[model samples]
Target: MNTTPQQNTQDRPARLTVGVVGAGRVGPALAAALQLAGHRPVAVSGVSEASVRRAAALLPDVPLVTPAQVLKAADLVLLTVPDDALPALVEGLAETGAIRPGQLLVHTSGRYGTKVLDPALRAGALPLALHPAMTFTGTSVDVQRLAGCSFGVTAPEELRLAAEALVIEMGGEPEWIAEESRPLYHAALALGANHLVTLVAQSMELLRTAGVEAPDRMLGPLLGAALDNALRSGDAALTGPVARGDAGTVAVHVSELRKHAPEALPGYIAMARMTADRALAHGLLKPELAEDLLVVLADGANGTHGTDGADGTDGANGTDGAPR
Candidate 1:
């Protein structure tokens, strides 16, 4: 992830003394990356044991101090606290006169934009939302993962250039997320990343419940390929029973889930319906075929018996579970 060299842009951003308000998963990683790019992390505020250990490991020799001390010692303040905690922290800092004008304040929260930093801005500070689009494990390894990543950046027009330059220095591509669109932008990430994690965990659990000892061995390749194709082709990458409009097979899947793993049925049905909808909209399944599949899904929705819609629309070898 060679993030050592930064592009010498015509409008270069100056390296400044940095203060990290939270030395949690994201803060230390950003601080380390910024340090690698020439900025100095003078102090950081960390309360939890994990945060303290993480800061020591990632930002070695950097002093762990109070939030007030952190703000007082730096030119750039990186506020990497939890999403819901940001506004109050900013207000408190502003109220105490800890944050002064001319300093730049950036937060790594994807759920918010520069608006959340209103208090600091009113007190004469530059505000930026510089969210890196990658998960962190609160380790030094995260520093290397910054390369070629996209950063959701939100800032006032005058500060956009400098914010983007910082991303480039840290080896990330800057993506401008509109202030009003921040919520929707964050929702998409949550749905895509967080929901994917839940779905996979559920699938693995169901596999184990079905007596599959090596669930990962069976799932790893298939999931990896599906994810890769989905990224490359969007809805066009869809495959299997739903995409093929195999009503009988779909019914069988619902029945098996309900009979053996009732707990997983709801999510399975929901995802199946969503897949059918996307397949229909993307022209992957014909209108008639999609209508047939939807009926089976609707039957599964009503009860554990997936037989109602399986009579007329099923393929010739109905119970064989073969795709169209």
Candidate 2:
């Protein structure tokens, strides 16, 4: 879809009226941000009473209404419902003729784009996707952090401009993405943000099993440094025994894991093999060394035993045994 910038408003509009449906973690946070950006959150709705109560507390001046009422009152309707519920909600709204011809319909789901709003589009509404590439921890702290974050925007030609404008108004940089590429982009975010949580949890469990008290304290500095390095140098920041192609050290880890944290072995092996592949791509490991390291990691995956190297020490070359 075309992504030309919308007609620039020299001055911000005086309180653009907004309606928020689904007062879950993301919904209320976004509604709060909209309010901060000089928007009037005129209506709020959600499936659960608790969610509705939460939204009412956040936007006490706004009326708590049914989804249909929100649609009717809002110039811009935000479907902050869970991703799976969005299509059904749009269909229901369209069937009820609640959506106006020129109203802007937006959703916060990262996994989907404007396609989920097909029903709204059929009813002549502008469909837009405005997904902030960040996690919601269900706190005001998260809402405060929304400023200057990157948002993934996708929509039809006419709606794309509106989507970009909205994101900019929210103090976020808009990254235009093809509608069909939303899934891949979401997956990348999941890998980096969500899976990183999984990896750290697994590592912490391993450390706990190894008798490390206060695992969080021990991991904090190490993770902080690693993250800083990754941000500054990308893949070049890789380190540790796996990046070094130190087969002997890896074998030691496998043996210790088998005894201490067998449950974490599979994840360790998977991440190690993936890291080895990255190291190879960076030319840090010779093909033979990479193959050997892969074998060790694969053995861990398969619950099998493997020798680290011929000499029972690290591999022959110091370069092969140093961290990448």
Model 1 per-residue lDDT at 180: 98
lDDT of 2 by residue, 1-324 (tens): 643222223135745689998888777777777777677788988778778667866777788889999999999888988878888989999999999998989999899988888988889998999999988766677667788889999999866787888887777889998989999999999999999999899878777876899899988988999999999998889887777667777876786788787877887787888888898899766687676777787788778887755466545343334333
Poorly placed runs, candidate 1 (over 4 Å): 1-14, 308-324
lDDT tens string, model 1, 124-235?
9999999999999999789999999899999999999999999998889999999999999999999999999998998898889879999889889889999999899999
- Location of the lowest summed lDDT over 10 successive residues in candidate 2: 2-11
Clashes of each: 0, 0
lDDT of the structure predicted as candidate 1:
0.87
- What residue pairs clash in candidate 2, if any at all? none
Q: Which stretches of model 2 miss by more than 4 angstroms?
A: 1-13, 308-310, 313-324
lDDT of 1 at 2: 35
Determine the C-alpha RMSD for candidate 1 after optimal superposition of all C-alphas: 3.8
